[model samples]
Target: MNTTMNEVYVILSTYNGERFLSEQLESILAQQSVSIRLYIRDDGSSDGTRAILASFAQSHAHIDVEYGDNIGVINSFFALLRKVPPDAEFVAFADQDDIWLPDKLIRAVDRLKDASKPVMYCSCYKAVDENGDFLWQSLPPEKEISFKNAIVQNITTGCTVVMNGSLLTALKIHQVNTKNLIMHDWWVYLVAVCFGQVIYDREPSMLYRQHGGNVVGAKNGFALWLGRIKRFFLYRKKNSRIAQAREFLERYKSDLSTEDSYLISAFLAYRQAGLLKRIRYAIEMPLYMQKKSDNLILKLQLILNSVH
Candidate 1:
């Protein structure tokens, strides 16, 4: 494959992101070793975000824009995915606030160069404040990225993701209920692990800016950690992950491998299973979060449900 000739469509979903949008776009435009095009969707922004998009699209021949209703982040991303050009050889998800490194797209394309089927590449990034000052680096990959982990948690963040055209085509075909997916990237990871491949790169590639504007951002430190514990306890009864997993299973049951099918079945059934049954399944389920501490907390949440 000619890396230089590959047409990559970078999809960006925006709301009120006029502040950092230009910087993010500039970084993306600086990528080397591939032909890049910017495709943006404005999710009913009331700010100057549309004006910024309009200005960029008018000056940049490769930039395209779409404006739609504010149907929520997950759906907005899915809507963007649906409109990706049929001939696009690769697709990368972009955030409105983060600044990507120069090599981000090139590295992802190179990693996925020899893939013969649907595949994905996602890398780590530096967590920064709204002003782009460093806060911390994203946690290194502590566990294998698998279908099991994808079912419980979304480690494949959209901003860090670059996927092949085949994966894009397949996703557009088997499109799950976007509303049911906790996130678009998670659904992409699930499909890749079940049918193709997913590569998790530990190298930092972007400045993941943390501001109140992020749909989801890095939450490090004691207060954020404590708030998570409180939120989990408060809303444990309505676990969204479990609901998303259930929806995934029902929609794509025929496509999953026999082993994955069984694992998902066991995971979904854990809530209703007897104590001994739940324990055995939980022990066998090889799911994990990015950190060991997070894994321990997940174990606690599981126990609470089982013994309640």
Candidate 2:
């Protein structure tokens, strides 16, 4: 463990993650990149999570663990960010249940060597059970990562990210709205996209595990199949969820930029709005101005044809 190369801190926030905490910790600790540090914050886990962490920290000199009240996940993460040592050159977020590939940090550091960017993320591949194996791969792929697609897809997986310390220094975590914003990753990505560069390695670097305890995961294949049997109902239901997300973004419009504002506006107005709303806004917003050109054309055609 040479202290010479730029140090990377792995920030992990745990809350009742006892079932998989050890595996996640080991996966990071086993990285070939020795210029690394592990920082774990226990969010008042009632489970044996804290005890397990204490046991592991005793042997792993580079691993540091802290305890705090049962604050929400976002707060726990921001609190971890606040504690990052000033000398740590890189910071990565870790989920308590995922397994990082041995070369993840090594490759990430290697990629960032000549990069002018402040943050980098890798593509994610799913590791799911038979119940929901096919959901993620079924979604359409963006040709590349950019501010435009990022607004919709948010391709950067929280656990796959590594942020440069320069970016962290510029971050004001406490000022962010912890209530409406779902997770720390979303805010981190938003900031990176807003003020710095975000690069990605188009490869999956971690086994993004799915279980009942996960906040979000793939839908059962059986359910997807059953939905196809009732296509109309399924379509409406999916549309409703997209509608809800857009509504949330709209309510937070004042918090975002015009460029970002329009992206979500089009995501709702052109790409996702109810037929009538789509038609009305399409005629109102300029064709070239909307980022999703294909969707815009479709909506404009619908507007001309008087489709409601």
Candidate 3:
């Protein structure tokens, strides 16, 4: 592939990330084999993040900064996605503090270059500490990547995600409800599986920094598992996976295939079904997370109608 012909617009949303922001920006700038235009939106940082971004934007013609109010991460990313130029051939999301590998953009572009329809490419990551020391590498998804799995679990890490022009165009067609989303990347994965294709690469693409300020860190051990258990028991109704799926169905019901439409409708119906029906749905639905243990928890959540 001619790397010069592939222009990738990377959208990054930052909040109080001044400490490692410069390093992240430099790594992105040093990406090999592709033309990159970095677009950043600072989510009302009280630190030196704005000044740092301003300095970089002033020095680099390809870097653009938007000093915006604090709209949270999901909305901030969605805002940046909306601002992506229509002529852009590819789009990728970036984190404020993670050091992207030199081959990140090129790898994504290579995977998506042949796609003529809506398609997204995402990969695993090597988790690192605040000082960029290796922690652990995230495991690739063991099960199939499909709408059923996406409805229940998100395997796509936002920083490793890249979308073709067709996928971006499909996403822009809908007025997305950021309030109903769990994460921008999760929603994108769901959409890609439902309406297009998702390519999952097992290779590590970046250094996923895990620190005190991480909104969502890499899942690797017992602590994360315990936290997930707690969250499952205390899950809120308005922001649960069911709510996200409901919002997705409402927006794209007419465009969904018959099987997909029924799957979502049945998933939603579990919230109001009786004990027997809920149990039956739990046993019958093909929804699953990546791990068997997590799949068990998901089934329990379904049987108890705890997803809502």
Candidate 4:
């Protein structure tokens, strides 16, 4: 079989997103990659989200909509994952409120095709308001990201990733059976870094929307930015978020023997609460460490690297 020209599946999950649904769909359907199929799973939205989906499905033969049992967003996406065709060469995730670039699929697929990597992800242009105003950006280099590193810092933007069939294989093998694994992107990234190759394009391809109703609104203004900086150093000092991430990493690390140890080391460092352990771990990887790295050498190196 000629797998090179196989179909691409954009598995999109939606809820009550009537306001931005059409725009998102338009952006996706307008992509230059025309051999794409939409596998949409709507989570029993009471708003006009279903209507918008119906309209798009009626007008586009490539679009197929599936009704989910109101099982919330994560489950709705998982439902689409289960229903994805066996012949899908590539799979990309889509949110209900983002505007994709015209060449999003083309660029991602081309990168994945040309490189030795099996997965491709890009950065996002965080659009906050009607003017497409700038919010912050997430353009962390892909080389610095991995399954272990993800536990310390989430560099993989969910909506900007394009993965291959290997992700589906990992999901089936890992059999992730968590009731609270609410973040699908993190899980998928984990699978990619663990069992497959992931290539990240530094270019931004999606217009990430931020609004009042979002689960976690984009941090805006100086005060919020400063607050985020403050919390970056202080949050793990007392909160359980770090512990939770570490636990997830530990649960899945056994599956990544083929990958490098960079991610695992980072995760272990974050899990350790002792200053001595953290310091020792930080010294070994002076150029890169997790949020909790507080060693003097690491700190000095970071300053020197940025002093120019």
For residues 38-107, could you state the per-residue lDDT of candidate 2 as single tens digits?
Answer: 8889988999999999999998898899998888777888888888976567888898887788988877
Q: Over 4 Å off in model 2, which ranges?
A: 1-3, 126-140, 218-278, 282-308
lDDT (CA) per prediction: 0.82, 0.65, 0.89, 0.65
Residue 237 of model 3 has an lDDT of: 41
Give candidate 1's root-mean-square deviation (CA, Å). 2.5
Worst 10 residues of 1 by lDDT: 299-308
Each prediction's TM-score versus the true structure: 0.92, 0.71, 0.97, 0.75
Model 2 gets an lDDT of 0.65
Clashing pairs in 2: none
Least well predicted 10-residue stretch by lDDT in candidate 4? 299-308
Model 4 lDDT tens row, 36-107: 889999988889999999999999999999876688666777788888866466788888888898988888
Tens-place lDDT per residue, model 1, 1-308, is: 64446668899999999899999999999887778988899999999999999998998999989988898788888888888877677899999999999989989998887887889999889988988999988765677777877777777778999999888877877657665667788888888887799988889889999988788777778867876777666644333777788888887898888989987887777788667776675566576666777677776666556311
Error of 2 at 18 (Å): 1.5
Evaluated at residue 206, the lDDT of candidate 2 is 67
lDDT tens digits by residue: candidate 3, 24-136: 99999999989988999999999999999999999999998999999999999999999998767899999988999999999999989988888999999999998999999
> What is the Cα-based lDDT of residue 305 in candidate 4?
32
Which candidate leads the pack in TM-score?
A: 3
Count of clashes, each model? 0, 0, 0, 1
lDDT of 3: 0.89
Displacement of residue 170 (Cα, Å) in model 2 is 3.5
lDDT of model 2 at position 67: 90
